[model samples]
Target: MEFNSLGVLMIITIIILILFIMMKKIKNNDSDTSKKLFTAFEERMGLTCDVIDLKEEIYGIGLDRSSNTIIYLNFVNGVEQCIGLSEFKGVYVHRVEQNKRSFGKSKEITEFVFIKLLPKSDLAGQISLELFNHKWYPFSMEELELINKWKRIIEENLS
Candidate 1:
């Protein structure tokens, strides 16, 4: 078979286009599933989320600005939690790290990451929304980024 430069270029472009479309579909599906999970939580609790951030296919966080409510869901663990901003003092990211020694080499590794909502009342314990856990999920900078973003949003709403 004989191939020209233009033909090769066209074939490469088509493959790239197909890959892009497939990625888009996967992203959309993730978003759709996150929305559905959030919606079900809202209905069950009689609340609505005005803003949502889908961190992954199995988890997301949302806020109901009018009600000052924070909603979270983790499908992987079947965990769901909600808290009102008025009841919390502030929100911040909590990360745990430990040094491990392997073959005389030490490296720091993150154990878990959480977005914690500190309540105003001493009687109320901190509400932790797990963003990542080394034992359960692979480590990714994206998870850290998402937790920080939510921390800022929650803090802004608190203030």
Candidate 2:
């Protein structure tokens, strides 16, 4: 077999081009999936508003302006829960440590955030919702800010 420098360069270029195209396709697919889920949620809730899609977590937050309600859609559990300011008590940031085995002999420690929900009723127990599982949600900082903003809004409305 006879090989030249130009041949090797061409092969590398082709591989890079293929990788670029594949990445683009994956990004588009994610966007499409998020859109479909958002539409279905809006239809089920019978109201439309800006919906924040935590695509990695398979859930979303939809604020119903007319009713002043916060709708939480959990795709994994197939549950739609709504919390009105009247019944909402408070929210806090909760953290948990997760340990995982990595690189055959190394252990990795990871921290995760959960927005704990509390209701005004004493009979109601606290609920902890995990922010994400496997991959880090890109908009996690923004999501946390949104949650805090909603909490303030709820408190104001309650009073």
Candidate 3:
């Protein structure tokens, strides 16, 4: 009986070790993707990123302080957009939420979130960087915080 218990403990330890290693590898892969995307973006745009946020695997945002340029990239879809701070008249956090009632409880569900950049000129189109969408990704508080952070950063640079 004691021998069987000891063997079980060993098995559990090994399983835990394997899980830890797998988690580490997954983290490393994310870092690698961010690095690659940053490098490619910098090279293609010919601008160095002074700050970058890549918490979301599907999307990334970067800023070039010297030139006051903000770049938004969609990694999975291969979509990229960049704009100068001077061109935008307003920066806003656009959030779409719906109230749902279930089980005698009310809850608000976020359907979409974005950082919208309104251009100064009416003819020029406004730009929106996607942070989260209920259809594609689950809502996250971190994304909310990130969108707010970037809004502040862009507003500061605009000033």
Best by TM-score: 3
lDDT of 2 by residue, 1-159 (tens): 246778988899999999999999997887677667766877776777553545433766666667666666666666666656566577776656566766776644435666667877899887665554435544356656765765555455552
Candidate 2: misplaced stretches above 4 Å?
A: 1-3, 75-79, 98-108, 134-159
Query: Number of the top candidate by lDDT?
Result: 3
What is the lDDT of every predicted structure here? Answer: 0.84, 0.64, 0.85
* Minimal lDDT window, size 10, model 1: 51-60
Candidate 3: lDDT over CA atoms? Answer: 0.85
Compared with the true structure, model 3 gives a TM-score of 0.89
Worst 10 residues of 2 by lDDT: 131-140
Q: Per-residue alpha-carbon lDDT of model 3 for 21-127, expressed as tens digits? A: 99999988987887788669777998898898875467778999988998888877777887789998899988899999999999999998888889899999888
Model 1, backbone clash pairs (residues 3+ apart or across chains), number: 0
How far is 117's C-alpha from truth in model 1 (Å)?
A: 1.5
Q: Record all residue pairs in model 2 with backbone atoms less than 3 Å apart, i.e. clashing.
A: none
> Could you tell me which residue pairs clash in candidate 1?
none
**lDDT of model 3 at residue 25?**
95
Flag regions of model 3 displaced more than 4 Å: 135-138
Displacement of residue 18 (Cα, Å) in model 3 is: 1.1
Candidate number with the higher lDDT (2 or 3): 3
Query: In lDDT terms, how accurate is model 2?
Result: 0.64
Q: What is the TM-score of each candidate against the true structure?
A: 0.75, 0.67, 0.89
